[model samples]
Target: MENMLQNINSLGLETSLTLDDIPNIDLYMDQVIQLFENNFNDSKRNQEDKILTKTMINNYAKGKLIFPIQNKKYSREHLILMSLIYQLKGALSINDIKVTLSDINQKIINDEIDLDSFYTSYLQLTGQNVIDLKKDMEERVKDVKKEISEAKEEDSGNLEQVLMISSLVHMSNLYRRVAEKLVDELVVDKEGKRQK
Candidate 1:
């Protein structure tokens, strides 16, 4: 009876690995970096892009802005999360977001939470209202610069403030989108897609 049971288990394992049964997996680390590099070249060198530099990336990776999978390589979901984290460089500070993400990941690993629900909660917790804050600030900066140009005020200080605020607003928008998108991509189950 024991040998029969063992044979059945082995058969089950083999069946699970069939091409049709393979899991809907996420993208790997290399793929994620490639995505970043591609975007970096295509985009203009704005304040948003500057924050995605080597120093910031290293800080985020070391700070646990991203979670590491053991034994197995990272999936597309992980890459998406990293990219999202990269976008968030302006708000919440590096350490703050990292700690929040780590706590969330722990809940996931412990099975105390499901990804979809977790994603929803995270979105609520982060507060999407701040995305508008960025947009408003950027618009204000633009308006100010337009006024300055009309007045022909060539004071470098005012010009600098306008540029700085624009950069901040852009970075804020970038980060908000990153966190939101990462959650959206990671939380859905493959079975959910079958219904669609």
Candidate 2:
């Protein structure tokens, strides 16, 4: 065991010590659980609730959402993304969310469309309506499928498709509500004009 540890270390594996390997496994595990639970509750909600449902967590593990960590532990960014998805709980289906996200990620491929900047812009354009958001979304969907097809031909995971998909999904959810509201407003305006 000691030789194996040494060999792993020599290879720069940096073997981690689990609670079981430590002197007080139970106590350590309890502390870890408590800390994780506290963080999970206390962390600020992003634009959306970000608190993931059990199904969401499972889907995340299944590549529906991607994070560097394979375990349940999630980063702040993941939390924010999850919250955004929470906002779209009723408005969009998981499949639609996946499509929208892929589009947003495709937009990010070039420096011209920085997601962070786009998010800020999305928020700033607060009063603007999203009547066309759906149409735009559909177009984006077509584009993403095209991108996926191109990538498939290349036989590549050059960007880790899951990560890109998850990240984009987060962005789409964040702005979806605003888009919905905008669409509603447009409908009302059109109706009013028709009545006039």
Q: How many clashing residue pairs appear in each of the predictions shown? A: 6, 5
Residue range 1-196, candidate 1, lDDT tens digits: 1133343334321111112221256544454455556554433344344424455545665777766664445543344455446545445566556644765566555757555544445445434444454445557656666666787876855575656557667776897778656644543532366578
Which pairs of residues have clashing backbones in candidate 2?
A: 50-82, 50-83, 101-168, 101-169, 130-182
In model 1, the runs with Cα more than 4 Å from the true position are 1-23, 38-62, 116-196
Task: Estimate the TM-score of every prediction.
Answer: 0.44, 0.32
lDDT measured at residue 96 in model 2 versus the true structure, 0 to 100 = 51
Model 1, residue 175: C-alpha shift (Å):
12
Off by over 4 Å in 2: 1-51, 61-63, 66-72, 105-113, 125-196
- Give candidate 1's TM-score: 0.44
Q: Residue 17, candidate 1: how far off, in angstroms?
A: 29
In angstroms, what RMSD does candidate 1 have relative to the true structure?
A: 19.5
User: Could you tell me how far off, in angstroms, the CA of residue 61 lies in candidate 1 after the best superposition?
Assistant: 5.2
Candidate 2 lDDT score relative to the true structure: 0.45
Instruction: Give the per-residue Cα lDDT of candidate 1 at 169.
Output: 73
